[model samples]
Target: MEEDKFIELAKKAKYASKKIATLPVGLKNTALLNIAKNLKENQEKIFEANKRDLEEALPLVESGELKQSVFNRLKLDENKMRDMIQGIIDISNLEDPIGKTLLKRQLDDGLILTKISCPIGVLGIIFEARPDVISQISALAIKSSNAVILKGGKESINTNKEIMRVIQEALDSTRDFPKDVLTQVFSRDDVKNMLSLDKYIDLIIPRGGNNLVRFIKENTKIPVLGHADGICHIFVDESADLEKAKRVVIDAKTQYPSACNAVETLLIHKDFKYTTELLKALEEAGVELIAKPESWHTEYSDKILSYKLVSTLEEAIEHINEYSSGHTESIITEDNKNAKIFMNAVDSAGVYHNVSTRFADGFRYGFGAEVGISTNKTHARGPVGLEGLTIYKYNIEGNGDIVKDYVDGTKSFCHKEG
Candidate 1:
């Protein structure tokens, strides 16, 4: 937990980053597939380790010291295990995001300029409860040819350790794979030390509660790539279908209420005729609806929802743009024009029409998997998969080219791109 030890790990990751940056795509995919196979083989070991974490977390949940939603995320079921392994396989199947030629230019005669995609050097990830993030991030970093150091919450320590062990075992079996491409740190001090080492860690991705993310963003000189809050919303327009409204709202709220993409606020147009019926359907499904104005900014992460009726579609758009955490938002409507207007006007990472906000996911978006979602304007936004983990650099191959010639206008240069 010492800062020196953490710095050592960061340095190793940086070294490993350079080593893995130019690896052939075939080796990366093989390593990823090996990880998936190992996870499938060692799932029982992981489950047993997860059980230990749950045993310790249960008391905290019962005593109200920990939120039940967090405990729910801490426990990994067979479904989650399957999804985790399959996600790794899917990532392996994705086109390698690194080393692709993004742009090519003919600078001049016997001169060429090329821009190619490359890894982001090193990533420092701090997340809570979800031990699956360990495997997902390892696969993504491996595929993207980036090195990563992970810091997980104490609640899932046993699970995280076991998953990382299996993943490392798989990586060790991989031919010529870098050893320190993935590192794990657990301790409050590790976080503090990680934030200070901006020289080594290129990006800090915090995937947890708002307070944890806010703390990291405030204290870190490293550029942070994550949203602090998941205050998502869904607006039901006046011409909305009653059935579609109920279906989308129910799925978005109850499908996996603890998910970051879950809808926390509902905005209904006042002219919508099925208000009473819609509210009744929600209550019958065990949703605790609150109409309080102050709850608009709240992320319940539970079956609780805060809702309000708006006078018009414009009002609904204004409210969402004002209070949404720039995460995901949805509109349930039968009118195509209204849906287009709402979709175009809302400023969020994802905007959907007549669909659940739960669709805001990397795997669901067909990017294989994600390290985390980003609300940042620059760099990665939405689900950060392989593409987001990469940046590009210019590579020019010239034969005795001189800037002085161009500067002095002795020879006019042609800037042509192919």
Candidate 2:
């Protein structure tokens, strides 16, 4: 697809999203239920498409470029499919973010000032081999009243196409949403086209590896919501309870080693009392330890981990500020003051206290499902949920009120609600 075609499609989506923004929440929920039903009915088709992708990806996995977990995420198992449906159903139960009044104030005589949430219009998503993203992000966008354009990695093109087809079938059965509201583009040129459609696309969310994110950021005219890497950190302060720190650190690194929120660096206080015991525990667990001097600023996404010794909280803060991917960072300490200080000082999307960085998720944060883990500081941060998918607008009402009358002394009016 050409850039112009994507821009054209985005234009149509912007118009469609406005209509969806006004759609009743009940109707939207019904559509979500329908989507879940459709996905369940088409289980075999979904897995077959995924299997095709995996069969091809086996070579890539063996080459060491792709992690085994990536392959696992790509395969659509029975449980994962059920989880995807439940995710959609969960989103349906949440209150619609659009059309909710955020603030109300009196601006002038008979003029009602209101700020309310609204759809972001059109959204562009660039992702990796996670085909379930088709259902997940699509569900959130629909609930939030935004149109979405998706671009999956070439390796998962077939899988994405199959998923999109199912989604369209659901939408068709429901007939409550415009088919153009969601689409998948297969070409690299189409992705480039999507990046250039800023006039219609309000935001571009890139969810994948560093190079893909960087490419999207560099090429897009639209503002991107992204984090290039997940160089998460776990700092164990001297005041930390050894048992708590051990549990949290182990869970953070080993829970799902290949995930974005997984801890890649472990920092221990130079005076950390249980250094020997903690080190032995981590080593025994099979974490490939890379010490400082050799472990320059890095984001080891696999089983690899970097170990650093910090003399004080200040040093820990410095190390994180210098090396972290600004994703999730955690500090384990029993002292209240140290925990507060560390939480405030760490420059990360999420700062944890005596907890695993893995807890930095939209679902864990009470959102039904996450669109992505955002490391960006503004617009959206942390786990992006339905609320993150929207923007706000000013809705001002006046009863034959004139700006000139309010400006003039004779007509100086009190700012009060009717």
Candidate 3:
């Protein structure tokens, strides 16, 4: 019975997805701006709802039923609330991602083939905590012209419900807006149903810890887009400036230790002159540095950092490629030659030089917001924004075009690339 209900809901979302796919950019922007306005107006109610969620989550955190990192994400502070509203408005200002011409080719004398960007039907979003994500994802979906079914963890159910309520009310108030564009589902069974109905859910985007992403990858036939771990790394080359290296490393790890982009591993060239000072600075910054550990794949999503000394830049790149999560990696160096080499050699979604890995964010990257940082080699990589959510379709225009005519040599394709 539960499966039937979910299937029905999925069908409606699929129907809604088609309707919104052709929506004009003005209407979409109106819907997004309304969502931002409604959220701004209902801040008090939303905070009250978040307070209830935090009250329930605290006991779980104390009993070890939930990690404190998750509790931090669960709590919706004033800054997060303000950012959430601003993100939606920012998205409304972004250029429309749909129906843009990607390619144009002359297939024949009168036949012209064009590739246009289009929505990717429906998106199934499974996230844990981070209720602020609801607004961001909803705004991105609206701007990208894709329907979404969001399944948030039970831990922040109250906050999720209230936020969704405001968003839905906003959508409802908008003129000529399609219904079922965003559906919020709960229960483990909803997850199972989402995984099973690959035809209905075009993509599965899981936003949470290693386990949740892995489980979605294992269970779903639908295409999954996300990174399981964020074992990011930062390497200090022999020519790295001591002061700049210290500042970048400190900000990367200690600025927001719980962030997925936070640097977890520190690598220093053996010949680096300021290695001792750099390590000392990190220790003074309250970072617990572990040296030469038994495992290299650990993602210490906390104040703890793992360190290693390598003889050369190649060794740092090699270590990063071996155990790094392919999320993000950065190199600190004054030598432009070595910096170029490090940036090219590191096999991660994001590679930086003379900067902190914390800059590997969509909002910081000026994408307004992101669905998530994807480590996948194909489709999309790094921070996935509006353009990432769209796929292209080929269309041919001709008075009379037949495959048989072209196959029989009566006519031929000009094959002009544009």
Candidate 4:
């Protein structure tokens, strides 16, 4: 599409977002349920479209032009379809995040103040291969009363278009639901256009590999909320339980190797007695361990893990803090004090103890689904859910209150919380 055309769509989205912001919770939930129902009824159509995408992607995968992971994500099955539809329903069941009273205070008689949660207006979401992200992000936007413009990977173009069609049809059937609340764009040029439209796009979320995310962040002046790397880590303390360490590390690295929360690096205390056994166990589980200094900062996103020997718990913490992408880190230890210290000092969005890093997910955290994991220090961090898409506004109620009277001390002020 042309740049001007894209901007026009953005303007419509901005207007629609304002309209959605005032929609009652019941209407939003009804729309979500409609989407879910429509998707369930049209599952075979989606599968047929996914089959076409897979057929096109097969040659690219074979020629090494496309990643096998991307291909795998593009090929949706019955299970994925079921999960996607059920995810929308689950989101509709969550508490409405908008219009909640965060703060209420009384400054004086007949003067009250309130801080109420509200939508962040229009969002521009750019993601790769995973067509499921379309449904998840669309559901999140509706539940939170925010508008979204989505750009998906070319590899999943057919599947994305089909899914979006179903979603739009469902919205059309629903009463009082704004169809412009969700929009889809296709083309590399669309991404470029999206980055430049910070005036209409309140937040830009890029969900893909390190290179893609880095490109988006470097080129956009908009407030980009995402992590470029998923260089997560796990450290095994000297007091760690041998069985637990092996179990957790295996799950973290081999459960779903391509996941962002998968552990890419493993730290072991130099004096830990089970180092040799743990390494052997990981190798048996199909994990290739690399112990080079250069591998510390790598996010393998595969069955490859970097290993290191730390002399102390503090050294382990320091290594993780230096090398991790601030995504998620875990410490496996029996010592409570070390666990507390590690959790406090790691400085990652998710710090765990004696558990697999794979637990670092929004749906697992019970937010139903997430837009994406944000490693940013400000605004939303971790798995961004419904609440993350909202900002708050202060509403003050007063009957002809004058600021001059307070400034002149003619009226006494009482600041009290309710």
Candidate 5:
């Protein structure tokens, strides 16, 4: 597609988003239920498309062009489809974000001011081989009343098109939402077109490796809502409970080694007398420590780990500030004072205490499901959930009042409660 064409489509989606923002919660729920129903009804078709993608991917994997984990995340099964359906219904049960009055106050004379939640217009999502992300992003965008355009990787083009077809069918059945509100571009050239549609795309969220995020940041003028990597950390304070720390660290690192929130660096408060034993336990559990004079600055996404011994709270703070990817950081401490200090000092989107950093998820946070975990401070910070998908606007009300009386200092400002 040409750049101009995508810009035009994005404009239409923005126009559609305006209408979607005001849609009733019940109506949105109905659309979500219908989507779930359709997906369940057409399981065989979805699996067939997935099979083709898997077969084509096998040769690439055998040639060492694709990782097994990437291939697994790409190939969809019945459970993945069910999970996607449940995620849609889960968003349906959440409260409507639009028109939520976050703040209300009275101005001079009779003028009233209100700040409320509203949609951020159209969003562009570019993700890797996870074909199920198509539904996940679509559900969150619609629930929050934001239109979305998806650009999945070429490897999952066939699967993506199939899922997009099913979703568009559901949207078409509604007849109110524009079918173009959900679009999937198969061509790599379409990414350039998407980047050029900044005038209509309010935000660009890339869910993939560092190179893709860097490319989007450098090439696009639109706001990007993704972190390059998750160099997360877990600090064991001197006042920490040794047993709890051991369990949480195991869950954080060994539970799922490939995830972004998995612990990449371990910081030990030097006052902790059992630091050596803790390190030994981690090594016994198959964590290959990648330590040097300054290895704490590294992020290990594989079986690798980094060890750091801190003399004090200040040293732990320095390590986190020096190495963290600003994603998720946790502290395992029983002392309230130390926990407060660490929470205040760690510069991350998620600050956990007495818990694993792996718990940093949209579902775990009780927001249904996550489109992606974001480290951006402006739009979204932690899990990009339904609430994160919305931005607020001011809604003013007045009883036949104008700014003329207040501007000249002719009227005094008064606070009133209704």
Candidate 6:
């Protein structure tokens, strides 16, 4: 599409977003339910589209042009289809995030102040091979009453198109749902265009590799909300239980290694007695352990894990704080004091104790679904959900209230919370 065409789409989305922002909760839920029902009824068509994507991706995977992880993510099985349909329904059942009263106060008689949650105007979502992200993100956007413009990876273009078509059909069938609430772009040039349109795009969320995220952040003036690198870490304290450590580390590394929350670095106390056994267990579990100083900063979204032997808990924390991407970090220790210290001192979105880093997910956190995981310090962090997509605005109600009266001491203001 031409640059002008993209600009037109963005303008339409901006207009639609304003309409959605004020929609009642019932209408939004109706749209979500329609989407879920349509997706379920058309599962076969979606699967056929996914098969085309997989067929194209398989050759690239064999030729080493695409990673196996990407290919696997592109392929949609029965289980993934079921999950996708169910996810939308789950989102429909979530509490409405908009129009919630966050604060209420009485400044003076007949003068009231209120802080109410409202939707962010527009969202720009760029994601990689995972076609499931389309439905999940669209559902969240609708539920939160925010408009979204999506750019999906070329590898899953066919699948994305089909899913978007199904979702659009559902939205069209429902009454009072605005058009252009969800739009998708399909070119690298579109990404460039998206970055430049900060006026229409309120937030830019890149859901892909570190390189993609870093590039988007560097190029865009828009506030980017995502983790550049998922360099997660796990530290084994001296008082760690060897069996627990092994179990947690193995699960974190092997359970969907391509996931962003997978453990990439392991830090073990030098004096820990089960270091040898833990390493051996990980190796036996098909984890390729690399112990090198240079490997500390790498996010191997695979079965590869980099490790180091630290002299003390302080050394472990220092190493993690220095190399971590501020995504997720865990400490395996039986000591309550050490656990508390580790949890408090680690400045990351998710800090866990005696558990696998894999638990760092929006769905697992019971948020229904996530737009993306964020490592940003401001706005939203961790797994971003409906609340993250919203910002608050102050509403003041008064009858002929004048600032001059307060300035002139004619009216004494008493700030009281109710």
In candidate 3, which residue ranges exceed 4 Å CA deviation? none
Ranking by lDDT: 3, 1, 4, 6, 2, 5
Tens-place lDDT digits, model 4, residues 33-114: 9999999999999999999999999999999999876776677899878888888899999999999999999999999999
Clashes of each: 0, 0, 0, 0, 0, 0
The lDDT for every candidate, in the order shown, is: 0.93, 0.84, 0.93, 0.93, 0.83, 0.92
Clashing pairs in 6: none
In candidate 5, what are the lDDT values of residues 220-322, reduced to their tens digit?
9998898888888888998888889889887888887777888988888888978878888888889887666365545556667877787998888887888
Cα lDDT of model 2 by residue, 1-418, tens digit: 7666767777888887777878888878888888898889988988899889988998999998777867766777887788888899999989889888888878765678898998888888989888888899999998998888888877777788888898888888886566678877888888877877777888999888888899888887788887889889999999889889889888888878878899999999999889889978887888778786455556666777888898889999998999888899999888889989988988888998999999988767777788898888787898999988888999888877776765676476566643
lDDT per residue as tens, model 6, 184-285:
999999999999999899999999987799899999999888988888999999999999999999999999888889999999999899999999999999
Q: Report the CA-based lDDT of candidate 5 relative to the real structure.
A: 0.83
What's the CA RMSD for each of the models? 1.1, 1.9, 1.1, 1.1, 2.3, 1.3
Q: Cα deviation of 335 in candidate 3 (Å)? A: 0.9
- Model 3: which ten-residue window has the lowest total lDDT? 292-301
- Model 2: weakest 10-residue lDDT segment is 409-418
Give the poorly placed runs of model 5, Cα more than 4 Å off. 67-69, 75-79, 293-297, 415-418
TM-score per candidate: 0.98, 0.95, 0.98, 0.98, 0.92, 0.97
- lDDT at 172 for candidate 6? 95
- Tens-digit per-residue lDDT, 1-418, candidate 1: 8888888989999999999998999999999999999999999999999999999999999999889999988989999999899999999999988879999999898788999999999999999999999998989999999999999999999999999999999999999988899999999999999999989999999999999999998998999999998889999999999999999999999999999999999999999999999999999988999998575788999999999999999999999999999999999999999999999999999999999999999989998889999988987899999999999999999999999998999877788988
The TM-score of candidate 3 is 0.98
